[model samples]
Target: MKEDYLDIKTPEYVAIQFQIAGLGSRAAAFIIDQALLMLVNILSIVVLYFVMVGMEPLPVFLSHSSFPVAIVIIGLFIINWGYFFFFEFFSGGRTLGKKIVGIRVIQENGHSITLLASFIRNLIRLIDSLPTAYFLGIIMIFFHPKHKRLGDLVAGTIVVHERKAKKKKLTPIEKEINLRGLSQNNLLLDEWTLKSFTSKDWKLVSTYANRFTQLPLKERNQLTKQIADILLPKTGLDSAGKTERELEDMILIIYLILKDEWEFEL
Candidate 1:
């Protein structure tokens, strides 16, 4: 069967694929979020009503002051903006709605979403909501090939269906790869060691992994040399015995180790 997927070539040469979430799923997620927001608003209104009633006996100056008004406005703003920002940032890009719908947001390059991007996207969400009921957002999602609304386009993010595997067991090849990545020589390499490589570095490794077989020998050799040169010393991998021709193999192993350590999420 044919399926639509977005293939992202990371700088590491790995070609990652994601199935994009369409208009209907996105709309459903948005509806759920809105319903949640309405619930919060109702609760806030009830609390504020009590507060106002309690303040009725206070000095007229305090009762008529703008402090209560200002507090109410701030509360609304936080409820609207904080809800999205905190959820997406802390939940690995899955808001309550998106999680329920089995979808999530990620960077255009397929990296996990960052807090800043989450803030920017949700900030622009105000514009997307203009002219009543997300009419503009709906139009953009309908026309854009990837189903991105204005906020997503502005923030360099896309919504994708979470890929869930039914089986928990690893295949023979998978077990072998995992064992290879966890060999005695790679024991020192942990999350801290992985942090030495930047996001760009990982992307390059990813690109190489996914595109390795397809790359021309000459280009592949060049990439292998370039990436190996940067990673060799930082990773503390000894290359004294290896030749230039073997550097590609070393880099490929490094990529595998890093991939196993940092399996991309969200």
Candidate 2:
């Protein structure tokens, strides 16, 4: 059957499917966010007006002729810019609208949204708003295969339906290892290394393990190397001459060995 899903490789080398949100859903979410932002703008304007009225008797205040207008403009700018930036960056890619709509933003590679990417996407919002009310963005989303707008394309992100659990299928090797039990082999992990990982870290590792096999060979190797580089030092494992496939296998072994701990933390 045909589906509208993005395939993310897990550390177990299996592909997990995440449904891509459609244009209608995205548009509805954007409208909700815009309405909320409008409410904030109105409240801010009223507060500022009251404050200015209270300061009317101040001496020489009128001498700074353009100050009030500039302040109002700057405040609007902050509300417009800060709202999305803070929400997307700090809320793990879900603005209030997105959360309500059961969708979220993520990198093309299925990683969490980064601060820089969020900033870039929001910064290009001006372009998306061209010809009034995100006309250009609407056109782009309608035509794009993934329903991504200009900002998403430029930032290398996509909006997808939020998933509660993305489980990874166990490989034959992993199954064999589990049969032998993790206690039999340390897999180079110890108490210190395990302690270094927080719930978030564990989740990331688990995701990588679950999604590893589904990723392209090059991307799988790259992510494996990147993750290994971060973990090797902590685990005191040497990668002096390990092949890419070997390094990838090492990470999978680590995840398998700590499956119980990860499951508990999750």
Cα lDDT listed for each candidate: 0.81, 0.81
Model 1 segments more than 4 A misplaced: 1-3, 59-62, 65-67, 166-266
Off by over 4 Å in 2: 1-3, 10-12, 59-62, 166-266
Local lDDT at 264 for model 2? 68
TM per candidate: 0.61, 0.61
Per residue, candidate 2 scores C-alpha lDDT tens digits across 156-221 of: 989899988749897855664466454426575668777886676667678887776578888888
Error (Å) of candidate 2 at residue 231 is 38
Query: Taking the tens digit of each residue's C-alpha lDDT, what string does model 1 give over 11-124?
Result: 999987899998888899989998999999989989987877887586665565686778788989998889898998899888899999999999999988998899999999
